[model samples]
Target: MTGRFGRCRRIAAALLTAVACQSAPPARAATPPDTTARASGVVTWAASADRMGEGTAGQGYRLVVHTSTGGSDLRVRFTNAFGDRPLTLDGVHAGLRARGAALRPGSNRPLTFGGARTVTVPAGAVAWSDPLPGRVPAGIDLVISLHTPDAAGPATGHWMAMQTSYTAQGEHTAEESDANWTRTTGSWWYVDSVTVRPARPASGAVVALGDSLTDGWQSTTDLNRRWPDYLARRLTASGGAVRGVANAGVSGNRILADGAGQAALRRLDRDVLSQPGVRTVFLFEGVNDLKAHSGVTAADLVTGYREIARRAHAAGKCVVAATVGPFKGWPEWDPAGEAVRQEVNRFLRGSPDFDAVTDFDHVLRSPYDPERLLPFFDGGDHIHPNDKGMQAMADAVGLDSLDCAR
Candidate 1:
């Protein structure tokens, strides 16, 4: 969240009163057949079009399907974060392609819904495709195609998805007979997750909430190492005991006001409230407020965090707050801002709002400067953490709180 740009930033400091959030009714107990063994969850990678800017190329924007030689549902999520006008979608489809560089539409498959031809996405809106009614057996490639009205920005994503989604394309199950998959990179516009659930009793989910740092800009393509990914690896090591992590970081997201990515308050609905089976949240945002925004103070950051906590508590979910790590020597660091960072860290460490507390700042900071990042952990930019540093973050947290329904 480098405060280098000029935009309204649209930080939804005020909550959206449109949707009444009463509460998620308690999940019903599992039946005799569906045991805790069948539980599942999803890890969602989130980002806004404006947040990525023109930084990333779309070459990496791809949706890959991996099934166990059986048929499964293909679900997708589309975003209109940068859409200044109505996003007119002519076609949305999925297909299979070969492994060569000339990644033309490997094969052809059409993704359709209720047999409709198009979907118009409103500005700043997200649309999910109904689960494909088909099944994809294992050992195959399913590629989702998105034809947008304009070019994507900041970065593109090419990764294995966790949830089921629908693009403008129709049912992306094993049946993409009329669709096509191609080799492309960069310019990925938005992100989503997908999964298949049969007669499962429960699912587990991780909430990774933060700014551009949490979004993982330059780390690597499709190699999910954005801190939360590391935590996912840890969970996987637990052997299906933990479900998955859902990422809620927006690029350029700040704690106080809206500017870069939708500010923390504005996106709580789309990122947090609307997530499926979310049980825990990891918070490592706010350095941007201390460094980028000029009028921000400790009180403002605390107030914003308190609101986040209240929302999480009301949802019966656990909130893990990480101290704002050191960023004193960043290309954009301000000395006064450093003071505010320290002050805010003090409050987060002792605050009762968070159900749990993690010391990311203390673990990733340099001993020499204390206010700068550890040399090895720096992702060149003093703002974000490197892969190894991200792994350290996972190790430092008390992940036991996410025990699956045993």
Candidate 2:
């Protein structure tokens, strides 16, 4: 009887242990943290890079740019995309612009790559600088000073900056005064884009992919009066989520052919999709294609637009398209080209591929002559808009439409 009681007690204890084990929750599997939630910097200003003239050895460039969104930890990108040999930049500096070729006192700061003072970018490649420990204010003129010690190949830069930048004979990157920088050039060399870390992690940017009109071809020099510039001002004043603006416009660029710069299709990834913190792509091109008379029909242009929209969508970006503006008085204007423009604009307005559409044609066209640009807004060449016209184009854009879900 004692042995039987012992056995029964043992069985009851085993059953209770099993019941307790079953009642307890299973061990939770460890979840990995989401790194994508972290904020990288957003591009505050950008210019598309192309093949400039041959690079000069021991040359220093004081490139001035206008910022659209202000933020901390400012960074800059240098392009060697058109270079045939490795480009070595020995000195690089960033500062606020006090005047022509002059930096604000005590604002000049040094930049590095991998914690080193010098960076070597291979041919057909680009390099980004380490973040500087300061804030860059919105709509401010920022100057980037760089010196290439052994640069002797095809130089990569923006040809029609429409802003005055300075060049010197030797390494004067550390200077804040205009004593060393005496020569002025209407271009930006080496440096392409500037980025900053905004306080809000949700802040995003839009890239204006266009041609000469978008490149500020005829706008007042050093005034930052491009249509995108006007748009940036509006965005800042409105206090909207999309505060950054990158102008990826290359003058004389075409949609299907490589001419002034790589065709819009070829350079789309580098100029638009690859930009950091970009939520939208504002496409305002195709004039060159129509004007060139390369047998490019409206259907062909539409196909190109579809491809661009498709690629941008795949990259999780919203696409906003604009109708081609009037250019009847321009030298390249013809009835056939005008017809093609009309058809393309119609397709852009009704296309479901685009998240939004801005009718720039309606905004710039003359009421008296539908095919011609408005005289008051024409920049004299009839293809590009003056300062007032640029502002009108920006005003025509619905700010709310820029903040679209991708």
TM-score of 2: 0.90
Computed on alpha carbons, the lDDT of every model, listed in order, comes to: 0.56, 0.86
* Per-residue lDDT of candidate 1, residues 1-406 (tens digit): 4451111112111111111222322222212221112113232233333444442212223344322112234445565555544443434544443342211222333444333434555556655554444443223344555554444433223222222223322222233332333333443445444444322335456677887667765455445556666776666566443455666666667866787656877777666656655777677788888785477899999999999888877877778889988876677787888889999999999998887788888998999889888989887888677777777877887777654222
List model 2 lDDT by residue over 59-87, tens digit each.
Answer: 99999999999888888888899999988
> What is the Å distance of residue 258 in model 1 from its true position?
1.6
lDDT of 1: 0.56
Candidate 1 Cα errors over 4 Å, as ranges:
1-72, 81-91, 94-110, 115-117, 133-142, 149-184, 190-195, 198-200, 403-406
**Candidate closest to the true structure, highest TM-score:** 2
Q: In order, what is each prediction's RMSD in angstroms?
A: 13.4, 18.1
